[model samples]
Target: MNATAVTVFHRPPDAESFEAWLDWMGETAFAAEGFVECCRAVSDDPALEPGFSVTFRSEALVNEFLDSAARSRVLAEGEALGIQRKSSDLVIVEGELPPPGVGVFHHSVADGKAADFVAAEAELVTLSATFPGFEGVALFCRGDTGRWFSVLRFRTAQHLSDWMRSEQRAAALPALRAELTEDFSVVAHTTPFGSTLRTVDGRTRVTPTWKIAMLVLLVLYPTVMTLSRFLGPVLDENGAPPWLAMWLSQIVSVALMSYILSPAVAACFRRWLDPVDGAGWRISALGAAIVVVLYALTLLLFATVKWLHYWDYNR
Candidate 1:
């Protein structure tokens, strides 16, 4: 299998049409070339413009699509839509599919010690690199949450187990354990599980980014409030709201949070659910993207539901 990296860049002069056009182009261009693992994402800073990046795999038999006449047409379509053509680049990279016996170690750290977890991870990476059949290491942590999550891909479980049992690896454990509030549990998976791998068109998108961001916020928000309440002095208390007011406030809060948070959540979905390559027929990236988009769309659905409920109750 040949792994190709495709990056399309466009600065939406207008935020209004940015999302619509992005989705349309992704569904058409990437999907046409069988590269559906795609995301049209913007940075959280709000100052930076947005861009789309996607990667897909092609076999020798059908690899002509990258250089075919259809490629020209797609380029033209993108230009007609005001997308900057020069910003796009397509190149083939050495794509690796994890061989069987790969184990993914997922860690969720305590309240405010994610940095310590990350420090430990760096050490683990340095130590593990010496092991045989170590394909690569990828670490993901959210800003809102203190917990750290990562996936380590290895050639075989035996390779990972051997590294895990090493004395050198053990020698570094003291520092990592000292930072942790409690012992971290490690899960060994000989195969990929959960919703981690999905293929779209012919491309595989990585897991989404938004989910990771939301997870962080989920941890950080409450932690901040708890700290403020316990560490700081509370001066005054307002009158408590009635039950109806409380429910209304909660609904409104949820709506606002989802609206502000949906983009990052979608990004996370795109990042994780992406495929390693186009080999099996288990699930497609289009299907996964659709699921992710729908999940984000649920925010609107919830808002509508609440609106209807409010109307009925008021009437």
Candidate 2:
């Protein structure tokens, strides 16, 4: 696609209204003269809002659509939903975007210097593709704001990181900058998986804290129960004080949760935990229900294995 029209909408207090507007605007956008494909994503940070990016194979056709009188007519309906069209420069968008990883670079190439800029970018793209896990890259000219968007995709975060931090890229920077009016900005797609949450250029958002709390409890409860049944007695019989036994058992619980179970459970239900994954009411309900069922099953196991119950021991 030669051009991409990127528009971010303000998220309403409720998802319903915003979604309805999305549906309507979505149809209107598709009906545009030069529609190629539309890609939509939410920011890692909830405070930033979500947006739709439509790509057109031909810039001239898209430009015609943008300037059409019909463009204002379609947007008038969104006014009721408090949607306002404000012009903001697409200067730099640095944040985690999703699954593998995609780094987006916005370059302000000076007028009449497109050829030189593309040569510089093409060299970087060719070099980047040789790196392990390199997938592909796309270059788009955002005629609306005279910005060039270079998107590079990799098969994994590690691959993207290697290319970004490689000495080769560092050395190539001066020549790349030589062709641009201003320094380019870049960042990629990501949502932290589980407790492995980390920020990339100040853009990683951890899965909701409460959700993480829930996953911890899921792993922690059974850990404590099992430890109390087995380890507690061994310590107690060995003349350890009651307080000391309890404290030791707690240490094992923390260790397992920190190094093992938390990451495990987080991996299992990562979709629900991630806000960017668009886990709606149904996914949330399903996840909670599954956890509750697991809780019941664990309780049943403890209830059935009577001899293992600490309270009933020696009875």
Candidate 3:
């Protein structure tokens, strides 16, 4: 089967209406003949331009979709909604579908070791193909930056994880590390079927583990403690069983963490979470201090409330 990628740029007048239309277009594409998959992302760096990357089973189907009345009608609506079409292109891909889970590994190779790194990368690719779920590998390098990007496709997330944590990969780590200015980085975007990892705008935005852990603790501790202290008694008063009350509290805590707390914390710490190159220790230290202060305040507030309740009970 042939695959084609289409990229279109447009400026939408109304954000809500534009998103609604985009959703409709996605459903329409899914129903089209020879549809494979379509992925859309609003550019994080730019506010106005949104992008879509779609794949089809054949070039004929892609042309058919372009010529269809449905596409014309959508275009008309987009025009009425003040969406100006910037440009569109169809790229024909000459290969089979990539594996379900794809990862783009970005490596900053040491100077003068580009050839050595390429040789090692070839051996690594050969070694990776022996792994159970390996599908394909593609290598790329930017002439300006001298940085390397390798895209590896695997059958599933589990299979990808297995290869990542495998003993063979571990054995090759030492040699790989020697030729790198910094440790390699990975950026992954997940889909229903699997996941894809690609650099966005020539850079990967991976928050460090320590920063993530700090942010999670900052949100999680307060969420769990607030639910346990205040909502626990309410659940008991409503005749909930002990186990049921605990379960309910956990459910609420998880919901808040997933939907609200985590995103908010990440936004608040975005700069420190994704620091620029050569950033000093002061930024990291300040983030840690903020989390420590939050923890201290939470503890003090809970302690004061507990002591007041104890005094009232004794009286």
Candidate 4:
């Protein structure tokens, strides 16, 4: 991959139509050459307005997509919907394209803490580079809200997880936290796995980090167990190397998590995940009941099938 190209658009008043246009554009870009990923965000403060951003692998590809008929149609639709194009800039990112695990962190800083926060953030950036799989970090402060945003790229999800769980990061958190007016927000874009959650209006609503972690654990545990207990032996019988077998198993696990398990879990927990005022306890209870039922059914299904024993595999 080459450099990343970013384009920003001013949100339209017709949120539904704008979102539909976004959906179409994203889908079309996926089919285009050198398309990496795209995401949109609506500013919490209405004065900042709402917009979307896209990252492409190269400038040539970006131009090709921009000059294409599909993009023209999308633009026409946006114009018809009264959407305004604010500004578009293409950045030729220097150095190698970072790995799959990319994420953005948005922080609302307290008054008078902007300079101090930037200084502390600079130190953290240096420290983060020393950790494994740290690709690079970019920091930007919005003039409107004085909010600080950091974009981080890591080699893989495991690498990102390792950094998140590191004691160094924990130790660095308090200094950063003291500068924040509210809880910091983070959104990941790990290729197929870290896709953004969007509302019907095309605004990005990042799922709370804890909820995402919990959902991953729920899907990951069974995936690993089943793959190891069953698929491991089959791969071994076919004379595949241990390392390759393990890699293949992981590939399957990620695929299932990305395509099947994550979506289902998100749908089932949607009410609790995005709760309305009075629906909290009811949604919680219902989510818990559904989880219990699913777990019970999974246990029952696995228990009846004796093709492979869960604990029989050698490490």
Where does candidate 2 stray beyond 4 Å?
1-193, 196-204
State each model's CA lDDT, in order. Answer: 0.47, 0.64, 0.64, 0.64
Which structure among the candidates has the greatest TM-score? 2
Off by over 4 Å in 1: 1-99, 188-315
TM-score of 2: 0.41
Query: Where does model 3 exceed 4 Å of error?
Result: 1-71, 74-205, 275-280, 306-315
Q: State the weakest 10-residue window (summed lDDT) of model 4.
A: 193-202
lDDT per residue, candidate 2, 1-315, as tens digits? 246555555555556776677676657668887677555433333322355566666656656656666666756766766765433212222233433455666789887887777777777777776789875555666554557766566777778877777888888888889878887754332222254343333245455666666667778778888888788878978999988888888888888777677767776886777654524888877888898898888889888998769776545
Q: Quick one: how many clashes does candidate 2 have?
A: 5
Model with the higher TM-score, candidate 3 or 4: 3
* Prediction 3 global C-alpha lDDT: 0.64
Candidate 1 lDDT tens digits, 149-233: 3445456767766766678877887777665665554421111112234322222344445434444454334333333333222
- On lDDT, the stronger of 1 and 3 is 3
